[model samples]
Each structure stands twice: as structure tokens, then as C-alpha cells.
Target: MNCKEALPLIHEYLDGDLHGSEAKELKEHLIACPACRTLFKQLEQTEAMVRSLPPVRVPDTLTAQIMSGLPPMKKSRTWTDWIRKHPAVSVAVVFAAVMFGSYMSMWNDDKNLMVKGNDLQEVIIQGDTVIVPQGHTVNGDLVVQRGKLEVEGDVTGNVTVIDGSVNLASTAHISGQVTKVDEAIGWIWYKLGEIVNMIGS
Candidate 1:
């Protein structure tokens, strides 16, 4: 094995997780390569020293304080048990009530808001205005086609702007490059194409 391959396998060898054949190959390589042998010895010594350190003890007073601060444990009941005990009609009624309560909780949120699904990691702002909140993360592409983007969050992928402005907060992080287009038509077309591609996927 070369240095690159053997380097990665070193950890596996130390942990005794490598297959017998792979271990033997690594060992043979180590025997032939003095540099690798020296590195392996250093790594082994470091591991040994770390393992020899004693575990820390938690103070009795601190442990007692933590236990006192915790709430009392409640009896656990399975959802299956609860459902089985109720009649079909009663179960349906309960389910509807729960769903209604869940929707009602979000009723106060602005109706104009559009929060993308989990899979839609990429987002393109195509309107005249857009707002991205703090701590929100976009895992894929962020294309500002024709609108304003106020970002206080992170974008994991590329950010592109076309014929519009983007206002970035200090907290914003874009992992990929930012590109801009000059014309409105090109921006709209690109955004539409991206949306179509997302839907097809």
C-alpha cells in the first residue's frame, strides 16, 4: 500500500477494525517504509498515553445537585396502547382534533409566507422582494432572479443574482460562488428552468 492509502488505514489498524489481509498488507508496507514505521510508532505511543489516562470522577455534591434539579419521571404509555383502547369513531375524532389544533397554531403566521419543503434545499427568489430569516439554512443553490434578498442565515450552495439586488447580513454564509446576470428576461428564464428541474427530480 502507498503512503496515502496506508495513512487512512493507520487508525483502523490501531482500532483493530481492519480485515486480516489489509492489516497484513499495511504491516508489510510499514516494514519496508521507514518513514511510515516511525509515524506508526509515534501514533501508537500517543494512543497508549491517551488510553493510560484515568477517567475523571464526578463530585458527589454536583451529582446530587443535578439529580435534584431534574424533574420527576412520569409513567410511559405507548401510542399503540392508547389507540387500541379507543373505538374507531373516537380515534378518528381525536386525530382530526389534533390535526386541527396543529394547523390552528400556525394560523397567526403570515399567509404570504412560503417555507420550502425539506428536500427543496435550493431556493431562487424571483419576485420583486424576498426575505430570508436568521438561522435559516439553504443546502443548495440560491438564485436571486429579480428581487431583493435579505439573508441573516447560511446558504450551503451557490448564490446567483440577476437584475436584482441582494442584502446580506453578517451571519450569511454561502458555500459556493455568486454569479450575476444583467437582464431580467435571462433571470426569469433561469429561475423557471431551475424550478422545473427541481420538480422533475
Candidate 2:
């Protein structure tokens, strides 16, 4: 099969929906086409990276915050009646509360170092610091969270340091993009993008 046909199958395979002979056909196409193989690998990395992060949950305080921000209810106006009458306002309040809760969690959490990747035998760990020694090579994407990453060898794929810092030695070689994420709000955008990709796929 051609790339045009294999593209959807790749997404379907990642989604765990591809099966039978269709899966075989897609595999054969990926093996034959370098571009498709690269795309599949990228999609795999994206999926793995997103899945490695802990699930974001709205904090319990969100309910109290939303309720406290609302105007005092009158004896004649019930909560259900108020919600029915102002559906849009209610939705907005809930959405705002959720966003605020997520932001709060993002700011308060992630104080410890976290690393996610595959085939990281070359990566060194010491307290909150991660190091890739000289002459070593990492085969896939490397992600470090709330820590420091020092690279002295080679990384074949992307390197993303979130809420952390990275130091690359003169001998360090990275084949893919390197990203340093310092902002707290970046998590929200990443989650949104992941959701969009999942829905579109």
C-alpha cells in the first residue's frame, strides 16, 4: 500500500484499532517507506510522551471556589432553577474553576525530578540530576521533568526538559529538537494539543 493509505492505518494502529490483514499491510508499507516509518515513529513518541505524564485531575477545591464566587442565593431561587436559567454562566463558571484548579496544581506539584523514555541505559541518575556520559548514545526521545539534564554523548531523538535546565557538553550530539520548558502554563497547552490529536485521529 501507498503512504496515502498507510497514514490512517498508522493512526488506527496507535489507537489500538488496527487488526488482521490491514495491520500486516500497514507494517509492510512502513517497512518499505522511510517517510511513513519516520511518521509512525514520531506518532509513537508523541503518544508515549503524553501517556508518561500523570493524569491531570481537577482539584476538589474547584467546587467550593465556584460556589463561593457565585452570588448568594435567595430563598425563592433554587440551585437547579438558577443553573437552568443561566446555563451559559454556569458553564463558564465551571470551566473557569477547572482551569484555575489545574493551574494551581501545576504550580504546586512537580517539585521532584521525573524522567520518561525508553532504552535509557546510557542515562545517569543522581538525585535531581540526569547525565549522559561521553561515548554513550540514547536511541529515543528523552524527557526530564523538574530536574537538570546534562548531555555529553548523543541523543538520537528529541530532548525535552520540563520545568528544568539542560547542559550540553561540547561533545554532545542531538539529532532532534531540544526543548526547555520553563512556564507553568505550557502543560495546559500540551494537554490540549494531545487531546486535539487524539480526537482528530
- Each model's C-alpha lDDT? 0.52, 0.66
Every model: Cα RMSD to truth? 20.5, 15.4
Report clash pairs, candidate 1: none
- In terms of lDDT, the poorest run of 10 residues in model 2 is 101-110
Looking at model 1, report the run of 10 residues with the lowest lDDT sum.
102-111
lDDT of 1 by residue, 10-67 (tens): 7678667888899999999999999778667755643452343222222334334433
TM-scores for all candidates?
0.31, 0.43
Give me the candidate number with maximum lDDT: 2
**Error of model 1, residue 67, in angstroms:** 62
User: Candidate 2, TM-score vs. the true structure?
Assistant: 0.43
Q: Name the regions of candidate 1 deviating beyond 4 angstroms.
A: 1-127, 184-201
**In order, how many clashes per candidate?**
0, 0
